[model samples]
Target: MLQVLVSRKIAVAESICSFELCSLNGEPLPPFTAGAHIDVQTPAGATRQYSLCNHPEERHRYMIGVLKDPQSRGGSQAMHEQVEQGQTLTISEPRNLFPLAADGKRHLLFAGGIGITPMLAMAYELSQRGVDFELHYSFRTQASAAFLDVLAEAPLARHVRLHDNAAATQLDAATVLAAPTPGTHLYVCGPSGFMNYLLSTAASQGWPAEQTHREFFAAAPIEHDGDQPFEVELASSGQTFHIPADRSVFEVLDEAGIEIETSCEQGICGACITRVLQGTPDHRDQFMTDKEHAVNDRFTPCCSRAKTPRLVLDL
Candidate 1:
């Protein structure tokens, strides 16, 4: 973790704030590529993962755009309420799970609301590389959108297409996704429903899964209507631990002196991914692709539960 000072806090849009974090020391901060995110230790002690919105070439500081969620589970609430411009924050190094497809022939980027954060970085990097790409951004209204000016300026303006719900030219995923090139890639970030619809449309249009990538802001709620207790056996010590239906494997293991590094407890960060030696997992995370989830070789312990009565973890 790095101790960084929040240098600037600017209201970029309605209910959204962009935080500029500079290193405490005079030294340059760690380097991060586009589509990277840092785990921020919120004032409420919750670890929230926020994507770096600034250009990857920048090393002096990191910028993250955060939208205030009305139903915040602790992360966004404390950030808006207690965090100040001069406050020091503990943040993890950059980790990129939503990297760009650098080898692709062409790129199609889609952004919805705050999901535009990472797309901004991708556009910057893609523009720097002088690649062929287009960014389509959708928002309820222009006021609710963040970084309109940033998207308007050079290096990003031409490649972007704005689609606000109030306007007639809203995003038409089916039409935009009509053509499918062999090496054309698609990337999207935004609300779960929007992402799903676009991805599904692309899939129906014969877009290969390998050519598509995404990053979710949050995991959809898992229905535990028929949840049951399960058992987990560690491969290291062969010790067994019982996981209650109401609790997660992360909590149960942490209580037994096992520490699993985790962020975005909602299962969207892919932080607490644990290898599964045996047994099936009721995959509940949006982090892993459907293909990865089908393998059943690993699962996020933060929110995923076991399908079998007992699971053998490679812990």
Candidate 2:
């Protein structure tokens, strides 16, 4: 973890707080691509992932916006009420699980509520590349919209379309996604319900899975009542281990002195994604895209188990 100073803290919108972090040593920080996020060590002794909202080209500081969740998951509340400007904080280097398509010809970015954080960085990068892109930001009200000041003067403002539900600015997914142009990719980040409805609309329109991308802040709950024990093989030692129904593959491996770097063990982060040398995975992760999971080449060991009795891992 890197120690950084919280140089600035301000209210970006109703129930939303923005924090600016700077390297403690007064030097350029590690470089990160757009759509990257860092694991923050909150004041309440809990770790949470927040997307880097500032331009990736700016190495001086990293910016993150946090919404005061009524759910009180500990991270958001701590960031808003406990952390203060000038306080020092610890954070992991940025990791990207929702990066832009390298060769995408055109981009359609959608963000809802606090989901706008990563979209800010992505818009900056896309604008710099001179790529054709549009950013649709949806919010309940202008008073509750975050980063309005930034958008008002930001270079990417021209490419932005604000959709305020209070103003009756309806966003018709079917109309927007009607013409499926080849090479035009779509990226969306938002509340699960918002994403589900939009993606469902896109799917109904016959959009290819490869042409869509998304990032989830949390995973939907899954049932484990019918879970069964499974065996996992480590290719390096040809050693096998048993994974119980109650324990995850990660827990089983760790008990045997196997270490797998992980964050968000709930399977929202890709840190624990393990390559599958053999056997199919009972994927329980929300990190990988559906197309990625269908390939069955990698799975998050933290929450994913094997469909087969015996599965092989690259280790």
Candidate 3:
């Protein structure tokens, strides 16, 4: 656990708060690229992941924005109500499941609500490098938009577009993702419903899967009412564990004294993904692409389960 001090905290929007964390010893923090996130150990004892919104060039501090989600399970609420400037917290090094493609000639970014956090960093990087990119950020209203003033003063300000639902200036995903251009890449981060709409629209518009990328802030609730008991075998140790319908494979492994690195156990993060030596996976994770799931060569043990009664894992 890397200890860091919260140097600053500000209300960026109506319900969003921005935090700047610096190394406890005043040393440079771990380097991170755009679209990277760190797992923060909250005061309430719940771990939460927040995207790094500061430019990658700034190594002294890591910045993140958090929305006070009403449905939060204590993380955001703790940060909002209990955490303050000068507070020290434990955090994980940066991990990126959503990375910008380096080869794209033209980049199109879409951000919805608090999803703009990662995009803001990407915009700064692209602008500094003089890359061709455009950002379309949508919010419920101007009052709810975070960093509007900051964006307005950015070097890429001319390419930034803001849409407000209350003002009837909503983004048309269909029109924006209508056609695919060679060497053009698209990235989106937003609510599940908003992301699904963009992905489906891009697919219907002939956008290649490789050129389209996305990140989810939270995993959609999955119903496991029909889950069944299954068995997992570790190929290296020849040890087997039985995972009950009510428990996850990760929990079963932990009970057996086997541990794995994991964040966002809901399958949004790929940290707990393991190679599958045998058996077909149910593939419930949103981290991997359809092609990766079709191969059935890898699976997230945190949330995914075996389609077969017994699964052989690389372990």
Candidate 4:
């Protein structure tokens, strides 16, 4: 954990605030890639992940944009209400689950609402590297659009396209993802509905799974009508524990004195992904691809359950 001081906080948009966090000491911070995010321990005692929006080359400080979500689980509300400039915050080292493809000839980035945070950093890096890239940012209205002035002043401003629903300027995923281009990669970060539309459209237009990348701010709420009580067995120790329907596998393991590294308990982050030694898993995570879920060799215990009566985990 790194202790940092919030040096500045500015309202960049209607409900979005951009914070600049600097090291407690005047030292260079840890290096981060374009699409990296840091887990912020909020005042509400919730560990929330926020994307780094500033250019990665600037190592002195890290910048993150936080939206005051109406449907927040206290994390966003805490940042918007309780956090202030000069306040100290504990943050984890930057981690990149959504990284730029090293070998892609061209990159296409799609951002929806607050999802533009990570894409902004990627744009800066791509511009600095003189790579071919374009960004399409969609928001509800011009007033709600974050970083408009900043984006306008960027050197790669011409490569950005903005669509506001209030002006009837909507992004047609069918038209944008009409065909798959060779050596071109697509990265999308957005709400679940918007992401589903883009991904389904891309798949229909012949886009390969490997060429498309995504990061979700939160997992879509899944129905638990089919969920049932199950048992989990440890491979190392011949021990088993009953996982009630109301409790997650992670919770059960933790109750039994088993610890696992976890960041996003919503199953968006792959931090708590564990190897499955035996039994099929009822995969419920948004982190892994369909192919990975089909393999059934690993599972995220944070939200996933067992399809069979018991799951043998390689713990």
Candidate 5:
């Protein structure tokens, strides 16, 4: 963890706020990519990841924007009420999995609500590189949308279209995502419902899985039907253990005195990722891409499982 100070705080939008953070000694922090996020240690010791929303070229500081989540499990509320400017904060180094890959000549960007934060940085990076891209920004209304002022002045503003759900007709998915084009990449970040709808619609139109990328802030719970038991073999330690359906892999491992690092048991945070040396893993997490899971052979043990009667993990 890195020690930092909240240099300043400003209202960037109606429900969105921006915090300019820097090291207490004003030293340069570690360099980070455009879509990276830092895990901030809250006053309650609850760590929450917030995307770095500012230009990475700026060497002096990091900027993080937070939207007040009404259904927040206390983290957002504590940040708004207790976190003060100039206060010292502990933050983890930046980490990025939602990186922009060069798959095509043209890019279509889609963002919903606070999901616009990371896409805002991507838009800036693409503009700097002179990449052809367009942004489709959707929000409940103008007041609730963040970064409108800054985005309006950007050179890429000509390619951006903002939709206000309150006044204008809802964004038509068909109008925006009509025909699939070759050499065009689509990026989406939003609520689960919006993401599911967009991805399903795009897939129905014959968009290949590789042509699209996404980032999600919330993940639904994993559901299991019956109490089926399974066995897990730790490759490194050469130990095998039974994992009952009622208990998660992490819980069983901890009970057996096997140590592994973990943070978000819910799977939104990619902390507990481990390699699946050999097994058909019944993946239940949201941190990894379907392709990544298939090829990389990594799994989040906190909430995933093995479909095979016995599985081997490189823990």
Candidate 6:
């Protein structure tokens, strides 16, 4: 973890905000991809992850935008209130789990609220490559969005659609997620409820799970029936941990002094990712797709579990 500081803070909107930050040591940082995110250790030491919106070619400083969530548990509130110029902070190196597939012929990007950050970078990448793509940005109002100028500067201004309405303008999941032509990929980032409905609707419309992609800002509730306890074996140490019926995998690992790189313990961030060497993973995290598991036997330990009694994991 590297210590950084709040170099500058500027209010982008009534509730949306942006910050220009740099390493406290004033050294150049590591490079990251388009959809990369950094785990921010807030002034209060509360760890949170936010996507990097800056261009990949620029590496001197990192830029991040935060939306003032009214329901925030003092994290975003503190960012809006106490995080000022020259305040010290600790941040993790960038980590990117949602990257654009090179083979995608047609790209459909969706953004809701602050979810536009990563999508903007994706649009930039696709534009640089002269790829065919479209972006659908949905928000409560135009004032609530950030970086409107950059979106308009893209190659396909006609392909950009903005819908702002708190009551009207329902996310037409069916229409927006219509059958993808061959080599088409759909990527979405938003709140849990919006993503759940959109994904289910897309699935109903015959969009394969592989063609649909999503990035989660928060973890959705786990859909489970009766309680079940299981054993998780750390492949390296050969030590088994008993996951209690009520406790989550994160709580158990932390209590055992296992240093798992994680930001959102709720499973929104893909930081606590590990390989599922054996057993069936009851994947509860939103960061990965079912198709990804078919090729790579990886899983997020923050929310995923084994369907069998004993599961082996690569720690």
C-alpha RMSD values across all candidates:
1.2, 1.5, 0.9, 1.1, 2.2, 2.8
* Model 6 Cα lDDT, one tens digit per residue, 162-247: 76766576568688777657799888887777677777887888887777788898776677677589998999999999998787
Q: Model 5 clash pairs?
A: none
Off by over 4 Å in 2: none
lDDT of 1 by residue, 99-198 (tens): 9986887899999999999999999999999999999999999899999999999989999999989989799998999978888889999999889989
Best TM-score among the predictions, by candidate number: 3
TM-score of model 1 (CA atoms): 0.97
Q: Local error of candidate 2 at 137, Å?
A: 0.7
Where model 5 places Cα greater than 4 Å from the true spot, the runs are 225-227, 254-263, 269-271, 290-296
Itemize residue pairs with steric clashes in candidate 4. none
In model 2, pairs of residues that clash are none
lDDT of each: 0.93, 0.92, 0.92, 0.93, 0.82, 0.79
RMSD of 4: 1.1
Compute the lDDT of residue 200 as modeled in candidate 6.
Answer: 82
Residue 41, candidate 3: how far off, in angstroms? 0.3
TM-score of 5: 0.91
TM-score of 4: 0.97
Q: What tens-digit string does per-residue lDDT give for candidate 5 at 59-172?
A: 689888888788878776677778889898899888876777766688888889888877888888888888889888888888888888878985868878887889765777
Off by over 4 Å in 4: none
Which residue pairs overlap in candidate 1's backbone?
none
Give the candidates in order of lDDT, highest first: 4, 1, 3, 2, 5, 6
Error of 6 at 294 (Å): 8.4
lDDT, model 6, position 141: 73
Predicted candidate 4 versus true structure: per-residue lDDT over 81-150, tens digit per residue: 9999989999999999999999999999999999999999999999999999989999988999999997
